[model samples]
Structures are given as structure tokens and as C-alpha cells.
Target chain A: MAAAAERRPVWMRAMIYGFVATWFILAAFPFIWTVWGSFKVELDFFSIADWTYALTGERTKAEYGSAFTDAGYRGAWIQEEFYRNFFNTAIVCFFVVCTSLTIGTLGGYALSRSSYNYTFWLLITALIFRAMPPVTLVAGYLLPFFQWNLWGHLATTIIVLVAINQPFTLWMLHSFFKKIPQELDESAKVDGCTQFQAFRHVIIPVMWPGVITTGLFSFLLAYNDFVVTSMLLEEKNRTMVPQIAAFLGTTYTEGNVMFAVAAVVSATVPLFILVMFFQRQIVSGLTAGAVKG
Target chain B: MKHRTFFWFFLPTAIAMLLFIAAPIVSVLIQSVFAPHEAVLIEVENCTPLVGCTTETMIDQEATRDLREAQPLGRFVGLDIYLDRAHLAIEEVGQIWSTSETWGSFWSRIFNLPFYRAMSFTLTYTFVVTPALIVLGLMIALAVNSLHRHLKGLMIFFSLLPMIVTPIIGSLILFWMVDSRGVLGSALVSLAGDPNFSLKASTGLTWVMLIIYGIWSSAPFAFVVFYAGLQTLPRDTLEAAQIDGATRWQQVRYVIIPHLTPLVTFVALIQLMDNFRVLEPIIGFNASAHATSLSWIILNDLGGETRQLSSASANSVLTLIGVAILLSPVLVRTWQDFKRKT
Candidate 1:
């Protein structure tokens, strides 16, 4: 009976490993396949003759006389002026991170430190907004932005995104600030530092981990946004994700899906690097919200 | 930490939330009640030799333009938009209920209406994906927790890819592979032994594909949270069960599961909120033909040249209501927890 039970777990362990490996492959394969398939000509990638054309680049060789091609990248980056959209996206993400974090740090610090009734309501107010879809707010921003002549610029998008991102950032950073022993900052204040000075001096040093995690989420929000960015920004001022979306709208008729494929791969590379560098922080940040925030 | 000092620190975010976040919800509420002004029309009397004293219905272009400029908010239509066929479709629902011969047909006919169609899919996606992801996440957490420490990190690194990729891009990657000419699609074609078989042509297949995508993308979030919870599981309880000669399954059922229940609730709550806003996949797959989500319907109104703000606002208000209804339990629970803690 012991031997039989032992035999059962041997396969059970194998089953567990098998399931884990299969899920990992499912999670990672689409990105790898798309990145590889982006390099081939359309015919080979979507070959009706055989799927092996995708792997061996049969039609890619027939067309470009090589197994690989940069035609899609060139088409997307240069001819499509995806570079301009990339620049716009970079500007938007950078400013959104900086602005949200600046205001979020101060506000989050206050929320964490306060022993007031209003803090609960304020956090609850933010919780409601954070739960809301961003597009719903885009509707309200439209008429005002148009009236004020502030609709399409990178600045307007930045300000709007910062507002949209602030609540979550504030909530995340507040929890982070609460983790530090209250005595550290209180001592700084008692030693003649003002509250701001305590924040600037004592709290700032130990707050990097939480702030970094919060800022990563902020970056993701601004970088990956589609509905607001696409809706608010005009044709000339669109960001990368919206531009990729635009490519789909027009290029499906023109059969330039490769341009979109390349643009998508380019956009994902930064996130890939971000995840690789900060896996632990990202995991912790995600669980942090579930636990408390 | 003083009130005066805290006031200054909190003012900027306070202003932002009040202006953008809080104000928009109010704006959507107001916009839903009031419709945009109808295009004004005016008549002009024309006397010409050919027709001889005819009263022509020519537009008073200047006056019409003036009226629109003067009252941009439009006439208040009250709840007409909310109750209309485009929205709540109350009349249609009643008619379908009275007319349809069979139960299946009745539900299908009601689902044909745009609002009901979107709501049906949204609720289904939320209800389906939340539990599915939770179970899958727990299993993966259990499996990964039993692994060697070095392998655990690598497995996690690989696992985070699906969740971290942008929704549109991630869906597009999967969409491409499932395109009829791509590998998976073509493989299915061969498997069916029918060259004409395509998922795009079938509603059931398209929905199944979307649900798979939803599960694929969100399960990692659940796994990561549950795995973290698993690390803190009391070893003493497990050893106690072992000394009692309990089977491994019983130990898991009794101790491990109980320990992970709160994390399970956390993951479920988050997934419910996230999956309800399933807009990007429909756009990426171009599968709106087969499936329409509530968020997608709002996007449809907002996207094109028409910019039907009134209809979109009504849908927004309704979707907000749906979310509130779904979220009220969590809110009440949190409020109770706060009361108890204080």
C-alpha cells in the first residue's frame, strides 16, 4: 500500500510539472510567435500553402530573397511616422509619472499620517473613481477640452491622464507610507524639521520601494491607454497604441498588417524589459493592493 | 501631521479628483437626462414666376445656427433615452416575452437588442472569468509553491507576461494566431476536415475564444496573489494534520484552502471589476459581429464621425449603475469591516 501510494505521487508530481510547463508556454508563446512572425512577409506569415512558411520564411525568401526582413519596421517607423507617435507616448508617460507621483506622494503622505474623519471619505471618494472606467471620464473632458481649446495637445492628454491616475497612485503610495514606523518621521519633526522637511528628509529615503512600484503602475497606465488617448487626441497628435489602432482601421484594406505587427512589437519591448528588471516589485505591488489598498 | 500642514499636502490631488473624476460622473448623469438640441428648421415664403406664390420650406440657416449656439445643452428628454429601444428596451422585452413561442427563443430574441446583448456578454464574462481564473490561479499557486525555490522565480517570470502586456496588443497577438490563415486556425481547419471552417463565422466559437483570452490574461494575477498567501500558511497546522494520518487531499482541503480563502476573495473581487470592462479584445479580434460588450457599445457610439454623445452618455450612466450594483456588496462589506475595526 505504501509503495502504491508512492507510485501515485510520482505521476502526480509529473502531472504538476506538466501543467506548470504547459501554462508557462501558453502565457509566453503568443509574444514570441508574434515577434518572430513580424519579421516575415505577409504571405509567409499567413501562408495558405503551409504553416511551415511562417517558420522557414519560404515566401519571405521569394520576396526579399532572405529569411528575414525589416520592411515592416521601416514601414511602421518611418513611412508611417510611428516615431512621432512613439515620441508623443514617451512624453505622455514621463510627465504623467512625474506629475501623478509628485502630487500622489504629498497627498498619500498626508492621508497616511492624518488621524482625521475626512481622510476616510476622501479615500472612499478616490476608490469610487478608481473603480470607474476611464472612458466615462473622457466623455466629460471632451466638451470642456474642446471649449477651452485644449483637446489634442500632449499637455492636455498628460494633465487628463495624471488626474485619472492620481487616485490609484495616492491610494498605493498612502499604504506604502503607512509601513514606515511613525516614530522615524515624528522624531525628525520633533528635532525641528517641519512636516514638509520630515517628508523631504526622513520619509523620502525609506519610501523608494513603494514609490517605485506605484510609479511602475502609473507608467503602465499612461503607456497602455487606448480609449482616452485615441478619443481625445486628433489624427496628428495620436500616441503609439492609438496609431497602431489607426493602422488597423486603414491598413486592413491596404493589407499592411505587418506595419501594425511591427509597431506592436516595438511598443511591447519596453514593457518586457520593465517586467524583466522589476518582477519582484511588480508582484509585490499587485498583491499589496489585494491585501489592503 | 498637523491638520494645517496636511491640508496643503492634500490640496492638489483633492482639486484633481473633484474636477475630473467627481465632476465627470455628475456630467454623465446630467447628459443622460438631457438630449442634444434637434437641428432647427424654419420656413420661407417664395414667390417665383414658375411656381407662383409657393411657400418653400427653406432652412433659416442663420436663425437655426443661432438657436444651436444659444442653447448647446439641448432639450431635456428626461428618461426617454434610458427607456428607449437603444437602451433599456423595456417595450421590446415585454413584447418578446409575450410573443416568443419557446424559452430559448425568448432569451435569444431579448439578447438581440443591443443593450441586453452587451449586458448579457458583460455579465457572462465577469461571472465566468472570475471563478475560472480563481480556480486556475489556486492550482498554479499550489503547484509552484511545491517547486524548488530557484525554479519558482523563473516560473513566475514567465507567468507575468500575459498580464503585463497591453490588453489590445496581447489580444492582437492571440488574434493573429487564430486568424483563419494562421497556424492555429489552419490546424483547426484540418481537424474539422472542412476548409470553410472559421471561428469568425460562428458566434459560439468566438465567445469561447474570448473567454479563453480572458482566462489566459488574468490567471497570473490570481496566481501571484495566492502564491504569496501560500508562503505564509502555518506549517504547524500541516504537521498536525500529517501526524493525524490525514491524506494529502484532506490536508489541502482543510488547512491550505482555508488559509487561502481571503486571497481568493481579493482576486475574485478584482477580476470581477476588470473583466466587466472587456472592450479591447472585441476591437482587436474584430469580433463585434459575434459579440458585443457594454463598454464596446459605448465605444461604438463614441468612435465614428457621428460622435453621438447623448446615446454614449446614457450607456455610460447605465454601465456605471451596473458596476455600482455589482460592487455594492464589496463596498458594504468594507464598510462593515471598517466599523468593526474602529
Candidate 2:
């Protein structure tokens, strides 16, 4: 009787399994299908006569004399110079993460340690800034950028992204810093250290875990950004995301949809690897604010 | 920390935020109320040999260039841009209000205007997606929690894909599959028993598709949060319910849900703000004909050969107001919390 009560009924077990299976497919199937389809000719990938052609790649076999081909990858990476955009993305993400974290740590540390009321107001101000849509801010930037001859440059976009990233970065690091005991730094101050020295010697070394987590988010923001990059960067300096968007405009007309597909797959690879390694950090970062609040 | 010390530490970030975030907002405000100077017009009398002199109004190119170069911020027009047809469309709304007999007709007529159309979709998407994602996330969290330990990690890894991938890429992947020639699109066509069926062709179905995409991409965030919340559940309370002969449903209803209520609100608040800025998915899906968002409208206005800076700025100001309204409750609650702490 105890065993019977402990175990779920057969129907209940089956229901749970069925639901999980559906969600698993819902989450995973699209990417798997697209990656598989990306190797084939457009005809086979988007086959109207038979869907199985996508899986079997019948036209691809006939055209390329093999089941798989890298024609799309060749066109995107070579002919279209996607590597330039990839390089631009790398540069932007690197600088944005470094600059945002440096300033964010200082500000966030101050916000956490200060016992003043203005710190509270500053945080509230950051929260309001965080909620404003990036596009709305872009409207304000155009006139000034054009006037100052700063439009369509990587440096301008990177600085703007860092500033936009500041609010969230500051908030996340502020919360993380709050968890660190104030006594660690206070004792350093007692031991004949200035405030900056205490922060540099005592707090900085222990802040890596929180900083790394915050850095991952900053990297993602810069990497996955579309609006800012698309609006601010020139055609030659476009990042992976805006480049992919640009691909769609031309690819659709030229019957080169597979190039866009391949480019998207290429763009997703680094993120895929990032999640694989930093899954724990990502999960924890997401819950940090929610759990505490 | 001393005030001077704190000031030095906070200066870099404060400068960044002030110049980029705060200044742009001020710029948007100023831009919204101003219009670019009209090309300086001059009237000239032209006479051809066989025709009488005719006074012709022509754009004075030299003067226009000088004017624009001198005052690059444009001429101040007060609130005219905000009231234009592309934005708030006050005159259009008034006409629709007076002419339409029923509430439904009035609403339909008003929605035909671009700004109202974008607002309706943005609001509907926000309100619908936030709650729906929370519910779906809870269900997934509960179900995944019941699975074997080994399978749990694998499920989470796969689940994070939709959320972690670039928004445009994820939407494009889904959009391709739902194209009329693609697999799901074909299956949908067959299911509906119509050869011409396409998800992108209808406004209602396009919205439903986008809403589904919204839930799919965001449900993982909620799930991860709720699942973490579930791990911290008090085991003794569950055992107490079990000893009381509480069925599984009753345990979930009475014990589990009450514990997870705070988490639900957290997820709802975060998702609301994120969904209100839905633009990339619309672009990825290429469904702007059927659906438009406030962010998308702003982007469209700012793009093209002639950048309509004034119009876009007005839309930006309006969007900011909407965000402020949506955010007031959070702010008020935060203030109360601060008061309590003090």
C-alpha cells in the first residue's frame, strides 16, 4: 500500500513523459532542422513537393554529387566577407565588456558601501534608465552623431553600448557587491589603507566570480545587439547581427537564402559554446535579483 | 565611504550614463518639438520668348544649405510633430470617434492609424506574453523537477538554446520553418485542408505566431528561476501534507503554489518590460505588414534615404511615457521598501 501510494499511476507517468517530450522537441527541433537543412540546396530545404526532401537532400545530392555541401558557407564567409563583420563583433564585444566592467565595478562598489541616501536615488535612476528602450535613445543620438561626424563608426557604437550597458551592469554588480562583507574592506582601511587601495587590494581579487558573471551578460548584450549596431555602424563596420539582417534584404531577392541560413548558424556557434561552458553562471546570474527580491 | 572618495569612484560610470543615456533623452525631447527648416523658397518671374512672365516658386538651394548648416538642431515647432498623423494623430482619432457608430467600429477605425496600430499590438503582446510565459514556465519547472537527475541537466541545456541565441536568429529559424514551403507550414496547410494557407498572410495568425515565439524564447528564463525556487521548498511541509493524505494535486495547490507566489511576480515584472520592446522578432519574421510594434515604428521612421528625425523623436517620447506608466508600480513599491528599511 505504501509502494502504491509512493509511485505515480501509470497514466500520470505517461502524461508527464508525454508533456516533457513535446517541450523537448519544441525547444530543440527547430535548430536541429535548420542546421541539417542549411547544407542542402534551397529547393530541397524548402521543398514544397515533399518535406522529407529536407532530410534526404535529394536535390543537393544531384547538384553537388554528395549529400552535403559547404557552398552556402563559402558564399557567406568568402564572397560576402562575413569575416570582417565577425572581427568587428569580436572587437566591440571585447571593448564593451572591459570598459563596462571597469566603470561598473567602481560605481557598483561605491553604491554598495555608501550609507548615504543619494546612493539609493542613483540606483533608482539607473533602474529607470535600464527600462527605457534602446531604440528611443537611438532617435536622440542621430542628430548629434551626424553633426559631430561620429555616426557610422565602431568606436561611437561601442561607447554608446557601454553606457547603455552601464545601468544593468551597475545594478548586477551592486547586488553582488552587497553580498560581500563590508568588514573585509573596512579592516583594510583600519590597516592604514586608503579607500581606493582597499578596493584594489582587498575587494578586487575576491570580486572575480561576480565580475565574470556580469561580464558574460555584457558580452551577450554587445554580441546579440541589433538596433544599436544596425543604426550606428556603417555598412562596412556592421556586426554579426546587423549583417545577418542585411543578408535577408539581399538574399531573398537573389535566391541565396542558404547564405543567410549559414551565416545565422555561424553566428549561433559561439553563443552555443558560451552556454555549454557557463551554464551555471548564466543560470545564477538570471536568478540573482529574483531570488533576493 | 567619504563623499569625495565615493564621488571619484562613481565618476566614470556617472559620466557615461549622463552623456549617453541622460543626454539622449534630453535630445529626444528637444528633437520631438522641433521641425527641420523647410527649404528656403524664393519666387522668381520667368519669361520665355513666346509666353508671358510667370511667377514660379523654387527651392533656394544656396539659402537652404546655409540655413541647415547654421541651425543643425532645426526650427522649434512646439507640439506639432506629436500631433501629426504618423504619431498621436489627434485629429484622426477625433474623426473616428465622431463618425463610427459602435465601439468596435471606432476601435477598428482608430487602429487603422499607424501609431494606434503599433500601440495596440505592443500592449496586447506585453500583457499576453508576460502572464502566459509565467504559467508555461511554472508548468515546465514542475515537470522537469519530477524527472531523473541525469536527464535534468540535459533538459536545461537544450532549453537554454531558444533563450540564449540571438533574438533575430531564433525568430528567423522559426519563421523559415513556418514559411508556406517549409515543413511546419506545409503541415499546417494540410491540417487546415487548404493549399493556400500561410501563417504570415493573416494578421490574427501572425500575432498568434509571434505570441507563441515570445513564450517559447522567454519561458526558459522563468523556468530556471522557478526551478531554483522549487529546490528551496521546505521538505517538512511536503511531508506534512503527504501524511495528511493530501493528493498530489492538493499538495501542489496548497503547498507548492503558495511557496512559489513571489517567484511568479518576479518573472512577471521582468517579462513585462522585455516584451514591451518587441522589435527584432517582428523584423525576423518579416510580419510588419500584419503586425507592428512601437520600437519597430521608431526604427522605420529613422531609416531610409530621408531620416525623419523629428517624427521618430516624438514616437520615442511617447514610448518613454508608456514605459514610465508601466514602471510606476515597481518604483512606488521600491520607494516603500526603502522607507521601511530606513
Candidate 3:
């Protein structure tokens, strides 16, 4: 703990500081630039006259009589009806998270407690499923979903996401459940509680930390999903990501690129807020598998 | 847990996976072997004023619809789609193999084929990005670990921004900046001393931009994992190395790296699988013209006015096989571990 033990040479310290500073700029500058540019008109943001026009918002000021204007946001949210997509995304993420977590907890709890060989196989199967890029499954879903009249619905997309999310959820929650000493549940069972009762009484109360962490990831998977949501959901039911993608298709032709820019910034804010609030959990959740393995 | 109790607990998730994950693989496999039913063509003679009894084929719409409605899985081509020019292109590949005079020519011809083009980009991106991210992540983790305690949190918060944002959105944010009219593109234009210099117009630069974006977006995951590993480093060994007059480089090279070897494997396995799919960035950066991944190919097939289900399904199967190949080592390791446990 002494200062001498932690000491580094001046040059090495400077190099470390310099490298971190460079990485910080690389990591943060793009989003900062985009967010700042979103409020400007397309010309000022994507200024060919001078790059500094983006910062000054010269054209935006000339047009709107202010340095900053809500034109992009207004166009995206009001004119293009981005709020519909926002609400659709909210509905999908809400149900997907809830359903996936409920089933994932039950399954993960079972996997952690079971000593059977099948449990090993089950976990391995989940691993294999986890490795499959979700887009690969979109082709498969299209035929069946269309036939069964399940395509073009939020419910279908949500269920699909929940299923797609199960493997990772089960893995994270299984590891977490394993960490909760078996004796806690075993002792509850000995007190005349059935397995279900024991789980309800002992495990559920203590499982929130892991559940919340898993829930954050589930929300991310559903929220950040493009392939499944885009392919499955109808245009009217598209989520935020796909809606932004659609914006690109039309916006470029119409010279409304700022709508897509504004939409991209808007889509990113929730994630920024998420990381701010759950940095510890997100970090731990990322490392949990790595460290344990 | 008893079998009965476990069954009850696991049933819902099992059904979900079976219906969504497991069933889709089967469906994709089946669909890959089948092309959409060909239009039922019929020969008809039309005696017009200008032309008399010129035979021509026309699509019999009613019969075609009936045929499709009857089967619904499309005509069973049985690997024909997999070998056709759009997919595996078995015949085209053979033609190139036989006619080409040199390996370079052979590869160039092969690269012109859509499937090979996508596969090359996917594989190159996977292998290149995975290792690059690991190195970059390790560097950042080590540098941040040395920072004063208060500064560490702020650094980490900023560092997570690239990774935490949605992949498409993150790429779009970067994409806009790299547009010809935007900041970075103009900078490159000036630096290159050419007005026409554009990242999007070149295959090599597009790949470079995407690979850079891949590393930027994913390095934080590696850093977070590595930083966490660093926290658990045994202090005594480090102090002992110091007492033995080990240099800072030696301490890191020997003591730190060896300890992080397992986590390196962990990150490598995860990153390999993740990078192999590299789809969203291609879409966001509009790099599809210059580069495409397996996932991108499938997306292209599935999107637009024409939904080439069979072609997409074939690509999906091929992509899964690639994943299976990439994943074999880990699967083998897990199997060995299970065997030892039992």
C-alpha cells in the first residue's frame, strides 16, 4: 500500500496518461459530436464549406435564427411519427425482459441446483444456441411466422427476442444461482418446505441482484436488436433501431439526414443513462463468465 | 433437484428454446435444400394479326399458386440452391479453379463471387478484430489500472460509451463523421492531398474503417473483463517479483499476462463468435458495396422487394457451419471438462 511500491517512472506514467486520454477521445468524441450536431441543420452538421461550421452551426442559425434548433427532433418525433416506434420499442423491451427473466430464473435455478448429467447437456445446448448469430434464425422464422400468421406483430417479435435471449440469461443466472450457497435452499426444504416453496421463500428474495443485472442485458438485447425486430415487425410496428434504419433509406433522398442523426442520438440516450446507473452491474456481469471460466 | 421438479422448472424455457432456437435451425436446414417453386410454365400458341402461331411460354399463375399452396415449403431443390451461383457456386468455383493460371488470379476470380467475398471479409474481420481488440483492451486496462483512483471511474465511464451504445447507432455516429462532407472525411481528403479521396469508395479503406469500428465498439468488453481480472491479481507475487529486481515490463510480461491467460482465452472465444457476425456496421457505414459478412448477405436476401427465403436460408446454414467451425475448439474443451468431471 506504500507510495514507493505503487510508484512508476515519470515517462511511463506520462505514457499511460497519454494513452488513456487518446482512448477517451476515440471512445467518447463520436457520440458527443453526433449529439451536438443533431440539433443543427444538415448543411451545418455535414458542412462541406468548413468542418468548423458543425461546431458553430452557422447554417442552423441562419435558418432558425438560433445556434441550436429542434428541427431534427421535431421532424423525427412529430413529422415522421417516431413516437410510435418509441412506444413499440418500449412495449417490446418491457414484455421481452419480463418474460425472459421469469423463465430464465426458473431454468437457471434448476440448472444450478441439479447434479444430473442432463444439466450439463442443457447448459451446453444453451451455449451452442448463444453462439448462433440471431440473423441466421430470421430466415427460418420468416416462413413459419408468415404461414402461422405470427409475422408482423409485436407479440411474435417479443417472444422471439425472449427466446433468443434465453441462453445468455440462463448462463448468467445459473452462475449467479450457483454462488448462493445450496445450504440456504436445502435448509429451507428441511423446514417442511417443498422445492417450489423453498425457492419462493429462500431464492427469490436473494436473487434480485442477479436478476436485475440479467434484466439489464435482456433489455439491451431487445432494445438493441435490429435483425429480428426489423425482419419480423411490420413497418408500422418497427422499433427505434429499424425506424432509424428506415429513416436512412428515405432521409438521404429527401435531404432529411438530420432526422436520422437526431434519431440516432435519441436512441443512444437511454443506453447512456443505463450505463451511468448500472456501470457496476454491467461490468460485473461482463466479467462474471470470464473470471469464473 | 429431482427430475420431476427440474422438469417443471425448466419446461417454459425449454419450450421457448425449442420453438424459437432449435426449431429455426431445422427450418433453415430444410429451407436451404428447397428453392421457391418455379413458375409453372406452359406453351401456348397465339394467332395474332402480325404473327401467326408463334409458340411462347407463360407462367400459369393459377397452377403455380395451387402448387405452392399444396407444398408451402417450395420445390425441393436438394442442395441446388446451396451450389448455385449466388451461394456456394460450386460450378463457378470449379471453372475458376481449372481456368486460372495462378493462385492470385484464382483468388481474385473467387473473390468476385458473392459468397466467397462475404466469407473472406467475415473470416478476416473475425480473426483480425478479435486479436486486435484483445491487445488494445489489455493496453487500456493496464494504463487505467495505474491511474489515480478518482480518475479511473471517469475514464471507465467514457470508455464504455462506444460499447454500450447500439451497434448500428454507434456505427452511424462514426459513419456520419467519416462522410465526404463531414469532419474526418475532409481531414482525410486534405491529408491525402486529393479532393476525391473517400473512405467509402475504396474496398481496402472500407474494410479498415469497419475493422476499426469493430475494435472500438468491442474493446471495452475486453477491457472490462481484463480490468476485473487485474483486480484479482495476487499482490504477493508482484511484490516478490519487485524484490527480485524485476523491471516493470517483466512484471507485466511475466506475472500479469500469465495470470490473465485464461481470461484471454475467454475473451478470444467470445469475441471470435461476436465478430464473425459483423452485420450492423456494414449496414450503418453503407459499406455493403465494398464489403459484406455472412450475416449481411442473409440480411440482404431477406430484405427489399424480393425475399429470397431459400437463398437466405442456405446462407444461414453456411454461416452456422462457420460458427460451428469457429466454436469447435471451445466445444471440445467443454466436452473434455465434462468428461473429467463425470
Candidate 4:
């Protein structure tokens, strides 16, 4: 975005291109190869006979009698019941996003609109909580969750995740609320609407960008989390990331390593789709945190 | 907003934070000082012919059960647990220092304790990975910034995938590729001209792989921040530098870097906090045998069958302390900024 009008020498320009092109390969190669190799059989994917067998799918054809097979996916999804984990993840993420945004929007709107000293302390508290590792807090959660018999359920996990996510959510949404001109809501009040009605009528429609941005992160936290979900949830109530980890534990020794590989690739698909669709918002969200601070 | 409105609006999140976040800190703090109750013992005289007059002690199940039911949060042990080997490891560390002949041997012995071992790795990972990723991120940002516009979006789309993908899943992808017979691992073996080379077998190589994974997953974050910061760079300054005969390198060193320093600080702060608790990669790579972080140690304690809550809580307390120490500078800066604003 800076001025590029000043002409650079050909060698310098080529060096830049070379560096970036090399990185592009390094960054993209693992994912591309993994996705391709997931279709192949185990021996071909992790071929000791010849490394080229991985690329050529030769061993896959010999072993599975086809170039591609769904054995790994089937093993992970059907035999392993990974679909339940997937559904658990969806339920957790859906509620986490909804709960976090509902509270976050109200709190964020108030923080931005108010002129109290407490607001500063509230934000600071969030910052501190955000810095604490989620695992450390999991220790605190276990005794209580176990005592209450809430340890293994998705609802318990959802509540904990939403709490863990609130700091970031509130911080992001607070900054977001700060950017929206206060005059919009002020005029709504002047038009004889109560504060709640003004917020509902004026702020709700305009708050989606910030809400969606925050919601994506909440979803990511709830979905991607292994420590809290793994520790808190029961074996019967596993989520995708933890289930993928569980795959490595069981599937590896069973010589079903390809099943774990397939699970990893399956888990990545949603994130890939997310990044593809929401790259710009995610980029802006990252910078927004920086710039605002 | 009025006080009434502020209170009502803030209540839900505040309550959530209090119950889940704030209350847990207090729970961890209290639990850290308490060790679980030991079972009651009863001395009984054996009057059987084979046993003669020998006495044996047995666990008093009724008394122990009642005792446990009474104080299930565990007996308050003060700082006894924290000073034990699982935490500060005061006596062991002292013995190691006193017995070891040299600093090299001293460190080796000290790290044998799980607490010190985890702390050593966590600090090393944080110190090493934070700066390396910052530099890598900046380079990537500069390179991508100079690319043709059409390629920029596509490059960014690919780059964001690694960052957005779950940490365990992302590392699993890399871990599989670096499996002994997998692509990158095979490449390394062939490059080294050693068929036996494998990431799984070596601690040093595993740490390298973990650091590389850290950079791979996190650079996109720094890149995005720096890229956005680049867009906000003053064009006039660059033009003035050009007029002043600054070379391309000079233009970057003086103009570009100086401008992006704040964003660098921002990225560095966040990365420090992140790299400190590097847990998932250890799990995903199955590399805990090679390296364990503070978060991993805490997980180990909590995940075990005994559920060492006291030990885990102590580690959690220490971890939170470490987080606070790392966070202080940023907090102070934030405080200063807040004061100025108010």
C-alpha cells in the first residue's frame, strides 16, 4: 500500500518474487499434499517402499484396488462415531457464539456509551483474563464441575468456553462499539425511545459486523479447543479436535494411522472454508485489535 | 449511558466472568494450598496362630470415608504442595545445585524435576519462537505487499488457513508430513544421508519441529497485522526518503520498520502470551516425551487417573503468576494509555 512508483532494479524485484514464491510453496504444500494423500491407502500415504508411491498412489491402487478409498473417513466417521463429535462441536460452537454475543454486545455497548471509571477496570480485567492460559483455568473448573456432576456434558463445556471467550469478545466488541458514532443512538433517545429500545432499534442493525467478527472467534475457540473440551467433556461427548487427538492414541497402534490422517484433513475443511470466505474480515479484525490498542 | 443502563447492560457479562473466570482464579488459589486427605490407619493385633503376636496396620475405611466426605476440597496444607518437587521443588533444586560439579550438570539435574523441565521449555520456546516468528512475519508481509494485486488475495487466503485451522489439527497435518516415511521427514532423512533419521526419536529435532509449527501457525497473524500497518504508512515519508537518496534497504530500515514498530510490539506481546502455553502441539505431535510445556504439565496432572487437583492447582497458580509477569509490561503500558485517555 505504500508508494511503489520509485522503480526498483530487476534483481531486487526478482529476489522479492523468489522469496514469496518459495514461501507460498512451503505454506501451501503440506495441506495440498495431505488432502491429496488422504484419498490414498495407508501404505501409499506413508510409503516405506518408495516415497514416490505417496505421490503416484501406486500402493493405494495395489492395496485398496482403487486409486481412492473412503476407508479412513468411514473408519473415523462410522466405526469411531466421529459424527457425534462433529455434532457436539456444532452444538457447542452455536451456543457459545450466541451466548457470548448476546452478553458481549450489551456490555460492549454500555462500555462505549458510558463515561464511568469502572469501564476501564472492566476492560483491564478482561485483558488479564485473556492472557491467562485456558488450561490453568481448567484445573479450577474440574473440582466444581465434578462436584456438580456437570463435567461430561456439552452444556457445561459451552458455558465454560463462553466464559473463556468473553474477555476477547468484550474487548473486540468494545473497540467495535467505540468506532460507531455515538450520535446515532443519541438521536434515537431524543426521538423518545428508551435506552433498551434505542439499542434494539438503532445499534442492533449496525452491530452485525463486529458481532460476526467476534462470533467467528467464539466459534473457533469452542470448536478448536482441546484442553477444556478434552478435560471437561466425557469420552462419549468428544468434539472434533479432541476426537482427532484420540484418533492418534488409538488408531496409530492399530495401524489405522491413515484414519487419523483422514480425520485431520476432515477437521481442516471447515477452517479452510472459513478462511476462504472470511479472510478480509479476519484480517481487518486482527489489525483492528492492534490499531485500537 | 446512565448508571442504571450501564449496570443492567454490564450485569450478564460481569456475572459470567465472575462465576467462570474470577471465581476459578480464587478456586485455583485456594486449591493450590490444600493437599488431599490421607486415609485413616488403624493398628490391629494379629492373634492367629501363624501371625503370632505380630501387629498390622490397616486402612480405616469407615473413618477415612467419613473424613473424605467431610472435607472433599482436601485438607489445607498451606504452602506445602507448592514447595514440593512438582512446583518450586525447593529441596531438590537445592540438592542439585549443591551436588552438581558444574553449571551444565546442574541444569541437567534441575530439569529432571517436571516443574523445572516444563518451565525451562516454556521459557525457551517463548524467547526463541517470538522473535523468529516476528522476523519471519515481517519478511512475509514485505514480500506479499510487493506482489501483484491479483495474487495478494489468493496468497492471503492460503496463508489464513494455517492460522485459522485448529492448532492440534494444523500440527497434526505437519506431523504426518514429517512422519519418518512421510514427505518432509523423508526429505530430511535423504538430505542427511541417514535412513534412520526420524523426528520421533530425537528431542532436539522435535523441539525444532514444534518451533517451526509455531511460526507456521502464528506468522499469518503477524503478517496480517504488519500488512494492515503497512497500508497506514505515510507515503510522504517514503517520497522524502527517495528524494534523499535512500536505498531500498535504507527505505525499509529507516522508514518502513520504524513505522511498523508499534505493530511489532503488538504482535510480540500477543505471541509471548501464546508461546508461553504451547500445549496442543505437544499432544498433536505426540512429542510430550521430547518436550513438555507448563500447560502440558498441568494437563498431565489433571488428565491422570488420580486427578492430582492440588498439584494441578499449584501448577495453575504458578502458571497464572508467570502469565502476570509476562503481562505486566503490556498491562503497565495499557494502564498508562488508559490514564491518558481518562
Best by lDDT: 2
Candidate 3, RMSD to the unseen true structure? 1.3
- Measured over all alpha carbons after superposition, the RMSD of each candidate to the real structure, in angstroms, is 2.3, 1.7, 1.3, 1.5
The number of clashing residue pairs in each candidate reads: 0, 0, 0, 0
Under CAPRI classification, how is model 4 graded? medium
* Candidate 2, superposed: residue stretches over 4 Å from native: A1-6
**Residue by residue across B254-327, what tens digits does model 2's lDDT show?**
99999999888888878888899999999999999999999999999999889999999999999999999999
> Which window of ten consecutive residues has the lowest lDDT sum in model 2 chain B?
B264-273
TM-score of each: 0.97, 0.98, 0.98, 0.98
Q: How does residue A167 of candidate 1 score in lDDT?
A: 81
Measured on C-alpha atoms, candidate 1 has an lDDT of 0.88
Give DockQ per model, in order.
Answer: 0.58, 0.68, 0.81, 0.77
Identify the runs in model 1 with alpha carbons over 4 angstroms from their true place. Answer: A1-8
Q: Write candidate 1's Cα lDDT for B1-342 as tens digits.
A: 678999999999888878878887888788788787766676667788886886667667787778767766567999999999999988999999999999999999998999999999888888988899999999999888777778899999989988988899988999889898998899999999999999989998999999999999999999999998887889788889988988878988999999888888778877887898899998888899999998999888888887777788899988888888888998898899878978
Best by DockQ: 3
- Model 2 local distance difference test score: 0.94
Pairs in steric clash, model 1:
none
lDDT at residue B336 of model 3 (Cα atoms) = 95
Clashing pairs in 2: none
Q: Global lDDT of each model? A: 0.88, 0.94, 0.93, 0.89
